[model samples]
Target: MPELIAPTVRLHAAWLEAHAEWGPGFHEDGFGLIPADEVESAAGFAAWVARLGDESDPAKAAKAGGAACTYRWIVEGERVLGGIALRHGSGEFVQWAGHIGYGIRPSARRRGVATWALGRMLDEARVLGMDQVLLVCAADNLASVKTIERHGGVLEGIRNTKLGPARRYWIKIDLPIT
Candidate 1:
């Protein structure tokens, strides 16, 4: 079964291969939110991995200009299927980006990978003390909208973002964490 695991160099080869398959400016939806330039080189990838560790500390995260976050790779064994990020605070960026972001490799799409990964991430959010989590997706991204809705996401509204119009949904997580 696929599970969320802490980001590690052991997955670097898989990560790089996945990115190469996706081409440039790949968005992991809620996970690999870093600038594309920051992940282009080995050194850049190393820096990004290091930054991920720092993002768990509020002070360190503040210095970097955002909320503390926990990032994980969704993998079944050694293959990296995707990634997810759970933010631990609120702010303009968080409000715009939502509390979580995630993406699945093209080869892994249409197999309920995103749905499963997202459910796991929501559980992670609950463990972090979140009562509800905001998840935003592009208005045209039917698959994502369906995934969010399948997980009990309620439509909050739409907001204009640089990327275009985004549908915002509030997912209540007061029940038992799955």
Candidate 2:
């Protein structure tokens, strides 16, 4: 079974492979948006991991221009299925960026990886004391819309973004954490 794990250099090989498979434009939303070039080498990946660690602290995260968040990779043993991030608080960009963002590799799509990962991430958010969570996705991303809906996400509305139209949904997570 896939489980959430802290980012570690031990998964660098799998991380690189997944990123390569996704090609350009692969969104690493939960990962502090680290550029592809920054993680091209082992040392670079290690540095990126350390940076993510720093960003998890509230003070450091604010200094870096965001709220405190925990980043975790969805993996089963050595294979990385995907990644998810849970932001501790909603900031000015919450309407567009939402509290959580995730991405599953192309090879892992349509296999319920994203759905399962998201469910787990929501649970993580609950543990962090969030009563609910906001999720935004591209208006055209039907799969993501369905995934969010499956988790009881209620459509809040759609708004224009630099990237285009985005749909916003709010998922009440006050119930028992799954």
Candidate 3:
């Protein structure tokens, strides 16, 4: 069974295997990877993992004046499957990209990994006091649409973005009765 875990340096080799499988690009989405991130070296990967951990710290994020984000890697034993991030804030990125973003490795597609990971992130959002969360995906990504819809996401229509036309949806988080 797959489980969510914080990014760790111990899994650098496993992560590199997964990253290579995604091909050459910064499209890994939920891994919090950026164009300038040098994850090829052990030191660079460790720094990147540290950066992700800092980003998840509310105090650090506040000090940095950025969104506090929770990044989780979907893994099974030593194998890395994918990742999901729950971002908190109404910043421009959150507005354009959405509160949550995720990607499952090509080999793990159609196996409910994204769905399960998304569901888990939604729980994280709820714990952070979010009443609803936004999610955007390529307009043509029917798989993502279904995954979002399965979690009760309501379409707010498609819009053209710097990345091209994308479908936006809002998933209302049902707060657990206190």
Question: Which candidate's lDDT is highest?
Answer: 3
lDDT of 3 by residue, 101-147 (tens): 99999999999999999999999998888999999999999999999
* Candidate 1 deviant stretches above 4 angstroms: 36-41, 62-65, 175-178
Better of 1 and 3 by TM-score: 3
- Model 3 quality (TM-score): 0.98
The global C-alpha lDDT for each of the candidates, from Candidate 1 onward, is 0.83, 0.84, 0.95
Q: Give per-residue lDDT, candidate 2, residue 51.
A: 80
lDDT of 1 at 136: 88
Question: lDDT tens digits, residues 60-121, model 2?
Answer: 98898877888898888899888888878877766568998888887888999889989988
Instruction: Quote the positional error of residue 42 for candidate 1 in Å.
Output: 3.7
Ranking by TM-score: 3, 2, 1
Q: What is the Å distance of residue 80 in model 2 from its true position? A: 1.2
**lDDT (10s digit) by residue, model 1, range 1-178:** 8988887766778888887777777566645555653665678778778778788677998998777988888898888888888888888877998998888888989999889988988888887788999998899999999999999999999989999999999999975646
Of the pair 1 and 2, which is ahead by lDDT?
Answer: 2
lDDT of 1 at 59: 91
RMSD of 1: 2.4
Question: Best-fitting candidate, measured by TM-score?
Answer: 3
How much is 121 displaced in model 1, in angstroms? Answer: 1.3
In angstroms, give how far residue 9 of model 1 lies from its true place.
Answer: 1.0
